[model samples]
Target chain A: MVNTILIMAGVLMALGILLALFRFILGPDVTDRAIAFDVMTVSSISVIALIAYFAGRVIYLDVALVYGLLSFLSVVVIGRYIERGL
Target chain B: MEIRETVGAAVTLLGSVFIFLGGLGIVRMPDLFNRIQAGTKASTLGTILSLLGLAIMNEAWIWKLLVIIFFVLITNPISSNVISRAAHFRGTRMTNKTVADLLSDKNKKISEE
Candidate 1:
């Protein structure tokens, strides 16, 4: 039952990632793309968490933590560049 | 134990659905700020719920999941705010239905000073 649910969650998240990717590629403006990228990162974090649960690895939580931080930093940097002349 | 696993999995599945809706919002929203708002709000909740579900499934990692949840909640909105502000400053065109220009006056004041 647990495996079945995890597989279902994985499929749903994969579909979400595909939508995010579509936005990222077809976005008219850089900010639109950035927004899509942000969504993608968050979804990926959830995916990582689900994967960890499936694998029964506590260590993967640490990976999720780092990835979340990196995603935040990347978004901030992108925002700064877009706001200014960078 | 079986009941706990089933409940956790159900919660996780719901969270994933929210995340999918957020992604859909990003693709369908009319403007940059709208997309940012949709993506940030929905995904934050989605991620938190999924993490909480995972914590429930694995009792030992509850503390670590709590920490991750804290980081996600803190950073998600801040990044979204930064992005929206950037888009505003960069003069990304707004949709026709936009109702307010609260930031325009502030931007003028800043430029004047």
Candidate 2:
């Protein structure tokens, strides 16, 4: 049962990533792309956590933590650049 | 097979669905700010839900999971707020259906003075 649920989750998350990528590719402005990137990274964090549960590894949680931190920083930097050409 | 695993799987599944909806909103929203609102709100909840589910499944790792949740709860809103403010200040146009824009109006008034 757990395996089946995990498979379903993987499929859903993949579809989510695909949709976010579509937005990223077709986004008219840089801000649009930045938000798209933000959505994608957040979803990926969930996917990674699910994968860690599936594989029975504790280390991957740490990876997810670092990924969240960097993604947040990237979004902030992009916002600053958009605001004032930084 | 245990009760905990079943509950955890259910929660994770719910979270993934939310994540999918966030992506859909990003694609379908009319403008940048709308997209940002949708994407940020939904994905933040989704991430929290999934992480909570994972923590439940592995009781020993609850502390680390809570830390991740705390970081997400703090950073997601701050980053989105920053981006939206930047977008507004940079003069990103709103949709036609937008009812009011006090900030832009105030900016215009100040410039007029």
Candidate 3:
């Protein structure tokens, strides 16, 4: 039953990611593109966590965590650049 | 066979759904500010929830996941705020909305006075 639920969640996440791709192409500004990039980061993190669950490996969880933090930092840095009249 | 496990599973699943919706919002929204609003607040929280679900599944990795969540909570809003302010400062006007031009008009009035 838990596996069934995990699969369900994964499917939903997949659909969401596809929609985000749409925004990436359709967005009218640089900031919009950046937002789409951030969304993709979040989506990939979700996929990583689900993969960890299916694999039942402790290593993958930690990897996903690290990746999430790194992506968050990158977003911050990029945002800062934009804020500084870029 | 266990209720706790079921709860964990449910939380994780729900988190996944929310994260997905956040991504959808990113793609579907028309403007930069909208995407930033949707992506940062919604997706970050949703991702953290998903992390928590995984943490609950196992005991040894819970602490590490908490650290990641902490970082995400701190960074997401700050970054989005910075970007939105940049967008505004750079004069990326909303394409299809009517807003009273108070700032410019006030500047002009002050200049005249």
Candidate with top DockQ is: 1
Question: What global local distance difference test value does model 3 have?
Answer: 0.74
A32-58 per-residue lDDT for model 1 (tens digits): 888888889988998988878778888
Deviation from native of the Cα of residue B74 in model 2, angstroms? 0.5
Stretches of candidate 1 exceeding 4 Å from the true structure: B105-113
Model 2 regions lying over 4 Å from their true place: none
How far off is residue B41 in model 1, in Å? 1.0
Model 2, span B10-75: residue lDDT tens: 788888888889999999999899998888789999889888887777898899999999999999
iRMSD (1 decimal) for each model: 0.9, 0.8, 1.8
* CA lDDT scores, all candidates in order: 0.88, 0.88, 0.74
Winner on lDDT between 1 and 3 is 1
lDDT accuracy of residue B79 in candidate 2: 88
In model 3, pairs of residues that clash are A23-B27
Better of 1 and 3 by TM-score: 1
Reference-based lDDT, residue B51, model 2:
84
lDDT of 3 by residue, A1-86 (tens): 87787788788878877777787787777777677777777667768877976887768867766777787787767777777734
DockQ of each: 0.86, 0.85, 0.67
Where's the lowest-lDDT run of ten residues in candidate 3 chain B?
A: B95-104
Candidate 3: give the TM-score of chain A: 0.85
